[model samples]
Target chain A: MADAKPETKPKKTHQERMARKKQVIDERIAKATEERGVLILLKGNGKGKSSSAFGTMARCVGHGQKAAVIQFIKGRTETGEFKLFKDHPQIDWHVMGHGFTWETQDKTQDIAAAEKAWAQAEQLLQDDSLDMLVFDEMAYMFKYRYLELEPVLKALQNRPKNQHVIITGRVMPEGLLEIADTISDIRDERHAFRLGVKAQAGIEF
Target chain B: MADAKPETKPKKTHQERMARKKQVIDERIAKATEERGVLILLKGNGKGKSSSAFGTMARCVGHGQKAAVIQFIKGRTETGEFKLFKDHPQIDWHVMGHGFTWETQDKTQDIAAAEKAWAQAEQLLQDDSLDMLVFDEMAYMFKYRYLELEPVLKALQNRPKNQHVIITGRVMPEGLLEIADTISDIRDERHAFRLGVKAQAGIEF
Candidate 1:
């Protein structure tokens, strides 16, 4: 008993542990065989929801796929994403909002803008040639009652089966969440803005 | 008294309300004038931490700025980001891990790889020419105790004043969080993988 090895036991245990872990992961990977487009919802108060969408769009472009972006709440065309992607042959970009809600100062005008944006979005939804679509900050329309959710949901449901969509915003309606294939809720643990740091270019936008 | 103008009262009230809101936002935006590099930590269990970083990288690149990415946990060079950005004139990319931890199966080698990756990261931190640096999944090293937190913290503190850095992973050390100017916690509300959907290219990658 005194001569029994101690280090070997731990080594064997470690190997066994790793083997079990690998098997589980491998099985999961194997079990997941279906390939199709998915609906991804990025929600929360943190700062990367739009950035993540743009990053995915960039990834899709990397694969030579066509992509489109419809900015539902932003009125500015000078954003970093717009500057970079506006003229790219692989990307189709649109800025639909007139401006921030406060800036517009009229409920009727805001509704009109949202309706117009949705019209464009509906057209894109019907375009099967597009591989991906990013509905940046589109949830705000639903939150502010600028756009009806039912028709939007119906359009999403009937969109091209292989067309991926990434929707980003702080306020997500329940219907969108219900249909999402993946949802990432970005939480704000801390922010430099609270510390009086200016939102700078190439970062905040 | 019954003849008093009801609609006029509400319209005036709305204007006053908007005026107050505008003042507050204007003050905040005006107060935040200082600009410099920031450390952003993206944590929690969700997809898009890396995607956010990549998106930010694209934004930075859009501004004609330079970026470098040191992927601490990814071993594959065939990822969509790599294919799109590998030879990009503005990006410097490196994949420093042997693969997932279970795939490596050796703590010694894992630690060694982490150390090597950190060494590259440390060097990049000192280079002011690189406008941004992304330490993808580097948190796993600190979580596993493969890399000491103090040295990394010190390097970050002493790094170029104008260089922005983004660290993405689920496990974040307190020191990193403490120094981070922005922190995004990505929570997984739902995942397609759990529903037997395969992780597809240009989306999962």
Candidate 2:
């Protein structure tokens, strides 16, 4: 026991620890072999929520799966994503063209725009043929009470079992986390904007 | 004062508070209007770090900016992303094709593979023509001591001023965060595998 060099850690311990960790992870991976649609929620104050949702959309498209996106807000911004997927056959993309709620300013108009977008989303949700749907900033609709949560939740519940739905926003609704199979809370610990770093066209838009 | 109801907050107070918040945000946004390529670090235990990086790459490509990806660890698996970008003219991608370290079980081979990949990455890093570069899972190389960190860090420090770099992985090195303009700590609040959900071909890869 006296000869043991406990103070100076050895490499073998690291390997052993990693091996054990890998074993547990491998088991979990093995157990996670079920194939089905998953509800993914990206919430909190972070830069990458919409980026993540769009990334997954690309992933879905990469697999040749049918995918659609309904932007609940900022629908008029000419994002690079719109240009990339605009002509792609595998993607069904829609933007409200009304811009942001604050910019629109009219409550009645905002409600109508949200309703129009929701109708498109409801169709996608109910379609058994579609593989994936992205509800971009849908959480804000529910948060602002522009649209009721029950109908959207009900649509999600009634969606085809194999259709994946991804919702991105800050401060998700009350019961969304419980229903989501994968949830990431992206905490913006450091933001360049706060430090006078501007949002680039390709990066931030 | 006598007519004021203490139980009901004044609407003007609410408007004034919101106006103050908006002013702060607007100031930050205005101050952030300066344009420069950022060094972004996505760290923590979450599912979408690499996906977010790739999404950025796609966004860059969407804007017609030249970009590249050097996947350090997960190079073998034919990701849906690879298929999507293989023929993309604006994007240059390289994968080790060496798979994971545990699977190879050869330190020399792993080091060699990492070095080969790093060489390509260095070329990209030094290329001013490339608007963006992604070192996918590059943090692992530093953590595992596969490649010397000093040289890589030097390359990053000396890279083109207008070039953007994004590094994705868990538990980044000490000095990395200081160099990063934006950092998102993606917390894995919930994972589907915990509930016996599996990684699908298009979804997980």
Q: Write model 2 residue lDDT over B31-145, tens digit each, in one string.
A: 7766778888988898778888888777777888899999998855467788888789988888863766665556677789899989999999889999999898988888888
Candidate 1, residues B71-112: lDDT per residue as tens digits? 998998778788888998989999998877788777888889
Give candidate 1 regions above 4 Å deviation.
A1-13, B1-16
DockQ class, candidate 2: medium
Q: What are the per-residue Cα lDDT tens digits for candidate 2 across A90-177?
A: 8888986375554555667778989999999988998988899989898898887888988888889889999999999898997787
lDDT of 1 at A22: 94
The alpha-carbon lDDT assigned to residue B148 of candidate 2 equals 89
What tens-digit string does per-residue lDDT give for candidate 1 at A1-205?
9987777444465556777899999999899887777999999999899999998888888888899999988888778778888998989999998776666767788889899999999999999999999999899999989899999999999999889999999979999999999999999989888877898877987
